[model samples]
Target: MAPETPAEPEPMPAPAVILVQPQLAENVGTTARAMHNCGLGDLRLVEPREDWLGDKAVAAASGADAVLRAARAYPTTAAAVADLHRVLATTARRRDMVKPLTTPRQAAQTLGGVIAAGHRAGVLFGPERAGLGNDDVALADAIIEVPLNPAYRSLNLAQAVLLVGYEWFQAHGGPFDMAPPASDSPPATQADLDNLHHHLFRELEDCGFLRSEEKRPGMKRNIRNIFQRAGLSVQEVRTLHGIVKELRHGRR
Candidate 1:
């Protein structure tokens, strides 16, 4: 009998990262560097500022020339994400549209699942100064928001790409030094967390806990990030509300 053939290894899953109207060749190169660092190879450019393969970009890439060389360019955002089944737009600021919003971790998991199910996915990064326009964002099925200090939340193009890429790596069962303990309570949905944020913010605002209207946004965002990191459950959220109420009443 013939020897059994060796089984083929499972193909690696990666999402396409599309840079929409990128402003700097250096940023594009750095983005390529970041993508390669996280084992993501698909790079697409939508109307980049300079020749992506030029000297400056190559210099910035720091030996990720293969990624730069294999990159594809498109004329518009629509064309960029045309063939993708799942599309996510990365932005620091919240848009007014009603769309499924996800954290980087959540988005990565969703993207990984989609790819595993035999679908193509892509992430869109807007220009440096101005992020995705409503039109560009409208094309995305979901918005990926990185919890950050609201006062200074702007992330450089490559930095934003790196973060999402890192999450994607982790989502795909990438080896890591540590893993978070599973939550006892059901995972809190984004809407549930948002409601808690609103409830807490209203109370804080009423009691002047977050003073300095100018700093209020940043302060609230920082507080929210703290809770988000904790991965609070429904029960925990209610308990915190009770504690806040009791403390406020006692002070009064």
Candidate 2:
């Protein structure tokens, strides 16, 4: 009789959790717990107001101190993400700038795809007082926002992370993709995206949709917003690029 082979486990992408200017150690610990619950272990702190490795954070982390022990700290958001090719920013507020806005589920889905391609991705949470600034969001490859009752949409730092992390876990059908299913890869690179943006602007100019390049800064933000929200694939971006190029060439 032939010996039976062991089944291969499905892969779960390990993601980094970035707390940008987190306000309290308690929240930091709680956030670590949330990440642990979702099978995520990496934590990065940026200019934290509270000592995450202190007693308060450890106490708040409850059974998740292990995750906290592994956490890393940075002086700036840029440094926190210096190594990641893909960045996802989480926020509760909407900006006037054009950028892609995705739900927690969508971000999770995108994360899955991005991870399949072997690129690093991190989820960014802004300060409790102001959330992520426009400049912060501008740096991210994607934006994730949770839906709550508009009347009272406020979510504590840990809760916001939990929601997103939970979706990410669900997307893989568990805390880890320790099964045989394969995932899709994320779209293009930042360079590829930048080129697409430039060509799209040129197409807009040809169509008279974009006027006075100085005023286009906001438009760039906005346009970036829409596509990021769409979470277009590499193939999709290529198609869009072709369309824009043809349009700019005055093709019928």
Candidate 3:
């Protein structure tokens, strides 16, 4: 048999990482190094306290010059993510303001979905001394809080960026191995899952499983979560549909 052709490399999902009022050049360099490590190329500085491209940063970048060279500077957080469709703000402290909060994993998953849908996404990291101010947080669509010791929750600029960047890489960087998996079964698509949910819900409603008006919302949510967590395959979804139909017919 002839040799198999090499597969093309998966395109890196570029999410712009904005550093707001960064205090240290070394931290900026280290952050760039972390960003490059996780396949993130777009770096933005908003009113940096130190020279973003100074020797301290370059030295700390440890050979991540490409990221440093291509970095951009902005006057404000709003200006940095103006073109992006979704922006997430990183903060350690609990805010009293009402806003959607997500973990790093969730944010990365959301970013993957946003990028897949051809929309721009970005993340904002505040200065070393103080995290994103209320005004900066207000500009973001969602807030990302890394779980830490409640008594002393503090993360340096590079550490926070590294954690987020690492998650994004894991979510969208594709399989590390070049070889395909042994299983040929395709994962069920969202539409397939939705159709299955609808079919199951209809059957449940017909059987008076959703008769409780007050509990219907919670019941539906629980059922959806159960199936979504399964990460069912296409054949598995079909099997589930068959089971639901059989049960309904037997009840009739």
The candidate maximizing lDDT is 3
Q: Which of candidates 1 and 2 is the stronger one according to lDDT?
A: 1
lDDT of 2 by residue, 202-236 (tens): 77877788787788789879998787777566777
How does each model score on lDDT?
A: 0.90, 0.86, 0.91
lDDT of 3 by residue, 6-101 (tens): 999869667899999998999999999999999999999999888878899999999997898899899988899899999999999878889999
Candidate 2 clashes: the total is 10
* TM-score, cand. 2: 0.65
Which structure is stronger by lDDT: 2 or 3? 3
Question: In candidate 2, residue 241 scores what lDDT?
Answer: 92
Measured with C-alpha atoms, the lDDT of residue 140 in candidate 2 is 92
TM-score of 1: 0.67
- Tens digits of per-residue lDDT, candidate 1, 75-181, equal 99999899999999998888999999999999988998899889999999999999999999999999999988878888999999999998888777466767566
Give Cα distance to truth, residue 123, candidate 2, Å: 1.0
Q: Which stretches of candidate 2 lie over 4 Å from their true place?
A: 1-11, 173-252
Ordered list by TM-score, greatest first: 1, 3, 2
